[model samples]
Target: MKSGWMRGIIILLVFVLGLSIGYFLPDRKEKMDVPVASVGDEIITELMWLNQLKEDYGEQVLQDMIDRKVVFSEANRLGITVSDKEIEQEIQKMRKAYENDEQFLNSLKEQSGTTLEQLKEDMRYYLTWEKLATKDVVVSDPEIEEYYNNNLYLFQEPEKVHAWQIVVSTEEEAKQVIRELEEGTDFSTLAKERSMDLLTANQGGDLGFISLNDSYFDPSFLEVAFSLKEGEISSPIPVEKGFVILKVTEKVKERIIPLDEVKDTIRKEIALSQVPSLPQVLDQLRKQAKAQILINDNGK
Candidate 1:
C-alpha cells in the first residue's frame, strides 16, 4: 500500500472527509428527511450513514486534521512557506503523467479519496513539513556515488529511436508519398508542403527522439519506428488518427542514465530517508507544541 501511494503520488490518507474543511460537520437533519436505504418498512437515512461514517473513522480523521494544523503552524513559526505557484507547478509536473487534468482528478478520487481543493490543502502542509524536516539535511558526494553504483538497474534505459514522419488521412495517400520518395522526391519537402500533421508539418515532419514508454505517440507507431534500420523509410503504418510514413533518422542503444544528472534527486532521497517518517515528525512537533485533544465520552 505504501509503495502504491508512492508510485501514484497520492498522499492524502483520509478519504471523502478530505473534501470538506471541517471534520465535525454540523447536523444535516433537514437533508436527512429522505431515506438512503429501505428494507421492507425500515429505512436507513442519510444522517444515519453520515453518523456511522463519523463514528467509525472520525478519530483517525481528526488526528490527521490535528497533524496538518501542527505542521502548518510549525512552518509559520519557522518563517517557512510555500506559494500557490510552486504548488501548481509541482501539480502540473505530476499531472503530465496523466492524460489530462480531468483524468488526474478522477484517479485521485478513486485512489486517494480526495478532491482537487483538498489535494492542494494537503500538499501545502506536506511540502511545509518536508521543507522543515530537510532544512539541515546533507547528503555527501560519496553517498550519491555509492547509491548510483548499487542501483544501476534503476537507471536502465528503454529502447529509443529518433525518427521523422509525414501523416496522412489514408494508407493510399501514405503509399503515394512512399512512391514519390522512391521517384526522388524529398521527404522533408513533401512533408512541409503536404503532411496533414499540423505540429510537425512545418518542421519537415521531425518527430525527434522517442522511446517505447513515451506517452505522446502510439506504441504501434513507436514499434514500427524502432524496427526500421537507420536511414530506412517505412511503409505506411496505420495509427489512431491516420496512416503514417516514417523515416528512421537515428537509433540509440539502451544505456544507464549518468550519475551526475541524477545527483540532486539521489541527495533528496538519502536526506529524506534519513529523517523520521512524516507522521513521526508531526508527532514530535505536536508534542513540542503540547497539543491536546478533548473527546467527549458521552457519545459525541
Candidate 2:
C-alpha cells in the first residue's frame, strides 16, 4: 500500500515532472530511503519507485533538469531576470482567455493536474527563456508594416450580425411567423409565443450574434443573416433543428484594425519569430555550459 504522503508527492510529481526536471534538485543529497509503502505482505519502498522512474525516464528527466539549470545560469550570467510584476501580468493575461476564474483554474487542473503556483513556476521559466532569446532582437517600423501587409487578414474583423431567431417545427409555420413579423406583429412577442427554441423563446428568440466566423447557426443561415440590414427579417431558412426566421438587431461592419493599434503586437510577433526555438536555445546553452549526462538506467 502506498503511503498517503508518498502518493500525494507522486501526484505532484506527475505534473511537476511534466513541466520541469526541477523536482530532484541537483544539490539534494541522495539516500537509501526506507519503504514508503507496502503491497499486502510485500513492501514497496521509496527507493524502489525512484529506481523504477529512473529506469523509465531518468535520461530525459535528467536532461530536462540539466537544461533548466543551464538556462537559469546562462540567464543569470547575462543579467536577464523576470520580476514578480511580469509574472503576475502573464498570469492575468492567461486568465483573460477563460470566461471566468473557475474555468481558468479548472482548465489548469485538467491540462497539467498541478497547482497554480507550480504553473506559475513553469511560466517563470518560459518568461526567462523569452528574455534570453529575444533580449537582442529588434524589429523596425518597416518590418512591422511589411508583416502587417502580408498578413492583412489577420488584422481585419469579419462582418458580424447580432440577430434573434424564431425556430418553428414546419416551413409553413415558419412562413406564417415571418408574415406576422412583417405585418406589424412584434418579432419578440411572436418569438415568445411561438418559437420552439426553449433556450431563446423567452428572450424573444435571440440566438445572439452570428458572424462569418461563428458556427452557432447553419453557415447558409448565417450567410442570409449577414446579408440583411438591421431590423430586416429573413424568410424561413431550413436547418437541422427546424426552420429558422432571423431578425438582425445589430450589424457590426467589418473594419480593418488600424496599423497603429496592432503595430506593437506585430513587432513582438516578428521579433519572437526571429528568435531561436526553445529546444535550439537549450542546445546552445548545453554547449555553452559544457553539460554532460551520465544517468545509470540499470537501477543499480
- Candidate with the greatest TM-score versus the true structure: 1
lDDT of 1 by residue, 33-133 (tens): 46889999999976666666567655556666677678888888889998998678667756756534556777877776667776676667667888778
Error of 1 at 9 (Å): 15
Error of 1 at 54 (Å): 0.7
Off by over 4 Å in 1: 1-33, 36-40, 84-103, 140-222, 225-264, 296-300
In candidate 2, which residue pairs clash? 1-38, 1-39
Q: Estimate the TM-score of every prediction.
A: 0.57, 0.54
Candidate 2 per-residue C-alpha lDDT over 107-160 given as tens digits, one digit per residue, 9 for 90 to 100: 776665655776666667777877787889988999999998999999888776
Clashing pairs in 1: none
Worst ten-residue run, lDDT, model 1? Answer: 1-10
